[model samples]
Target: MYDSILVPTDGSEGAEAAARHGLNLATAFDSQIHFLSVVDERSYSSALADLDPTVGEQREGFEQQATEAVECLEEMVTEPPVTCQTAVKHGVPHEEIRSYAADHDIDLISMGTQGRTGLDRLLLGSVTERVVRTSDVPVLTTRHEPDRSRYDRILIPTDGSEAATAAIAHGVAIADRFDSTVHALSVVDVGGVVGAYDAGPGIPELIDSLEEECEQAVTVVEEECENRDIDIVTEVVQGPPYRAIQEYVDREGIDFVSMGTHGRTGLERYLIGSVTERTVRTSDVPVLTVR
Candidate 1:
């Protein structure tokens, strides 16, 4: 699993946190890691616009800066049981990174996020968010410092949908590699109950029905874990889907989160982005989004 992990760094502290996590994963799996620092042409255009240099001179310096950043990142990486490769490219960061992953056949993409940045106003998605949309492989991303307790437990969030099931296979592979426990959770979307709204006399029946549905959902997860030797914990929470997940992570002390993208295409992308973006934007632990 993850024979070659690719990490895109922008020399930000958030990226530094993710780089360290990528290194640790490489160490665990004895798999190679690639550290790529792409210098976006847009950033260059903004910074060097007033330099008053010839176009060729600007390109030379941009290329040189990209090279130097990659070298600096390489020097910062101290631990590696697996081989590490470093390179830099010039172009739109997201598109260029996606193409690099495609050309190199990267197994998994590891990236860092700023946690608060959602979709950019101009672009449909954030750069980190956009790659997850386009990447054909799994993506493991972290915005916060990784908890070093050694991934003793992983949390899998599912709606019992087809895409979520596909996500579990990738997550189980990670658990098997790390010898960790896997916990599965189903969140009932009870957001309608939240707010200053009023409920009728049938409220009790609605709650009862929702609870029963949650129980059935948890049962499915339990059955999936029954044949495995790894310890599995299952839970069902009632609230907005995102709120339930965020609360569970804090309540259960989850080390990492494994989630599925509906693999929504065309118009559905806006929908898929809502769930994943909220999770990545809020989760304190690492998140692996499987498509």
Candidate 2:
């Protein structure tokens, strides 16, 4: 379903890993691939130039690095059937990426969750986070080398919101392509509920109600998979959503994860706290997020 894929690089180990995964997807879909490297103009602005005499040289060096980054990604495309292109832009990294995707009608934007300069393990890379939060298109992110290009088992975490529905469609499409088993999971977020309000006599009934809601949430995903004749396993689990998802991935040997950037709010906002962000930051495999 991905006709055009975009891989934004910074010549980092993390970016290289993400590019390799993007190349794998392009091969599977026969999709055209575009590699983009952006030089942050803020690094060489006039204010910095006023303090440093070598600002001109720094700008040129940044431009060259950006050019080389995309060139490296372009070299990764060895398959003759997959078309590839490259470009370098001077702007904020995330903005340049978003503009390029929109301008080129990119079907997917895949990149590293961490940039060349590693980010804090607890936080997503700032640029990558900005792109994920703002981009209209789906973004796929990975922080480490991918073990295998093909996704044999895909996990879809849902919270029964419009955002979750969008994620389901993308996840199912990819699973259909790879003939992968789909795992549909919904978390009861007991921790969040107890933290937000008083845990009194009504807590048991509340948990039961939340579990039932979780079941219904995953059932929608089950129905969608059934329509496509795809094998799906559905479950409703109780815990912190992101932790539950990570546990599920490990227990099931899931190779990929797809979920929404946002979901239902309030006590049912199991998919909030940017659960997608937390998952993207910590997942061993690539996480594809749809808005």
Candidate 3:
């Protein structure tokens, strides 16, 4: 359903990987691709002394880097070419990204969870996390370069909340486009439930009730896939939701993951950090998060 896709880059290998995936989607949908690189003025302004002679030079260096980054991605677009555009802006990286998407009427934002200056750890790059948390549109993120032609299996994890259900249509749309099998998963947070209360006589019955809820949740997804006449598999598992999702991806060889930015317990402003944020931070495959 994407008509215009935006790929924000910092010229990192991670950003390049995301660009490749964004290009693949653009090619599939005959969509226009916009490559944007943002020079984070704060990075230099906060470090250098006020009115320092080097400050202007540092800003110019960053702007040049931004231009080069977009140009590098532009060069990658060829052979059955999709429409492409490029731009560089000076601002907070995440704010500039959101503004670009809004100003360009972007349909999808595909970006990397890590960048050249990213924290070398399991957490997502700060800018990417901010965009994912606050963006008003769907965001597709990845940490590794993916096989562009290999969206053969798509996973959709659900918790039956309105937020979780909101992701199902997007997941199904992508599967429909790729002719991929849909794996509908529901994770029961046994540990969270148990820890919230005493592990006493009522626990077994509570667990069974939770498992039934999980089954019903997956059933909803199953019905959606069936209505679309898409091949589908459904399952219910018990664990921390994000860990269960990662395990399922590894076990099933999932090619992509689609999830809601928030879940049943999500706060109004914060994402369900333990689940969606963790999955975005740690997923080996690309994740499309819908709010």
Query: For candidate 2, lDDT tens digit of each residue in 139-187?
Result: 9999877777789899999988889989999999999989999999999
Candidate order by lDDT, decreasing, is 2, 3, 1
Candidate 3 lDDT over residue span 138-223, tens digit each: 89999999866669999999888777788899889889888999999988788877787788998888778878878888899899
State in Å the error of residue 197, model 2: 3.0
Per-residue lDDT of candidate 1, residues 227-273 (tens digit): 56567888777666677778888988888888887633431121145
Q: For model 1, what is the C-alpha lDDT against the true structure?
A: 0.70
- TM-score preference between candidates 2 and 3, better one: 2
- Order of candidate numbers by TM-score, starting with the best: 2, 3, 1
lDDT of 3 at 161: 76
Top TM-score: which candidate number? 2
- The better-scoring model by lDDT among 1 and 3 is 3
Separately for all candidates shown, the number of backbone clashes (residues 3 or more apart, or on different chains) is: 0, 0, 0
TM-score of each: 0.81, 0.93, 0.91
